[model samples]
Target: MAAPTAWIVAAAPLAAALSALAAAFVTGFDQRSAMPPDLAARFYGFFLDRYPLFAFAIPYGVARLLAVALAPGRSGALRRVIGAALGLGLLLGLSLHPTFGGMVLRAGFGTGSGAFLNGTPMAAAYAFGAAAAAGLFGSALGLGAALIGRPGTPRPGSRRRRAGRAILHALAGFLALWFAAALIGLAHDAGFGPWPRRPLDARDAAIAAGLLTAGALPHLLLVAARLRRATRAA
Candidate 1:
């Protein structure tokens, strides 16, 4: 049981490293196509392609897996921290994409009459953001439960505080944070070319998805194990 959590914790750095690798690939692709001249109009194309894999898939997947794998058991505090970091990181990462950032800049910096034509890329950006947010939301709920959860070895006749309440609190927190970041990112783009859109490429997508699975799948299995234990105990 404890070994699962250990495995999940071990996977965090692996996930982060994989995420960085994905980001690098995306950046690499963008750099390659930067001066092709033929594909210039797709100024934001590079970002559009790779954003989902790096920003959403890698981070969110890894974190969720960790959450599920590290079901509270005895080391509740550590799990809570890992879960919170995942949620917060996803919230921040989702809002930082070029499309969203560009929109924020355009709204603020376009000519007084609004000359800037910048707009969201739509499909990839929003989709990526949404996925990341979802992951964060789930982690918050899962971790919150661990935080206020009853000890496995409770005294006789003790009532477990509502796990559902903790879950809700975590979920609400993640949503609030995500929405707030989205709003702020929008605002920032309005003010700032939001410059240099970092287009995501195919490699980025593949790596992100891979990293996500590598990180999260195990954690989910861990969570399942916990649920099974609980059921058996009852």
Candidate 2:
């Protein structure tokens, strides 16, 4: 990969993270208040209910696809598998959009009497689903790009090879981050750890932010290690 292409590939994850962060703020969830289980469930449901899938998910998929297309790497049969998964994920994500059937489900099944079964549990499931969709979309894009674009030849001081490796490392970091976030949410819901309570005041917000950073550290370390390896190889 050329310097320009490497930078472009790196932008995908950055864009995704920024978009999600912005969405959180826009939804006024930057400082959530703690609630009982029932209320928590409804909150989760309504939160997902109003989410803008098009603003985030669709663009995320497109950016990842572009990243893969422009990245230099060797393609294989695995690319086909990844592409298929990407298609399926995108379809599911579209179906889960608020304006589609997801709205009905949220209103009918995610609130009121039906909410007991559909609220927090459904929200948790959706979180996992969204993460899976994002991962599959990104992997497919990267894999497809490697297949359709120039293949990197591994040799001494090969920039293309370095770029390809860097992309893989970045993808791994993204996956790690996603899984870590999901696990943190699950643990909080399960009452496993000292998760910050709602009404996230300054102290609570600081604690929550610190916990999130701690959770992400391992993934960041792995990314740093991979980059070091890539540099050494180059």
List ranges where model 2 is wrong by over 4 Å.
1-182, 187-204
lDDT score for residue 193 of model 2: 26
> Candidate 2's error at 159, in angstroms?
18
- Candidate 1 matches the true fold with a TM-score of 0.31
Model 2 Cα lDDT, one tens digit per residue, 100-202:
3233223332343343355557665555554653454445444444445433344365798767866776577567646544443343343332222222234
Q: What local distance difference test score does each model get?
A: 0.42, 0.45
State which candidate has the highest TM-score.
2
Clashing pairs in 2: 1-160, 32-199, 33-198, 33-199, 34-198, 68-145
Candidate 1 lDDT, tens digit per residue, 23-118? 556566443444656435433443433222323433443444444434445556655566556554543333343443233223222221222233
- In candidate 1, how many clashes are counted? 14
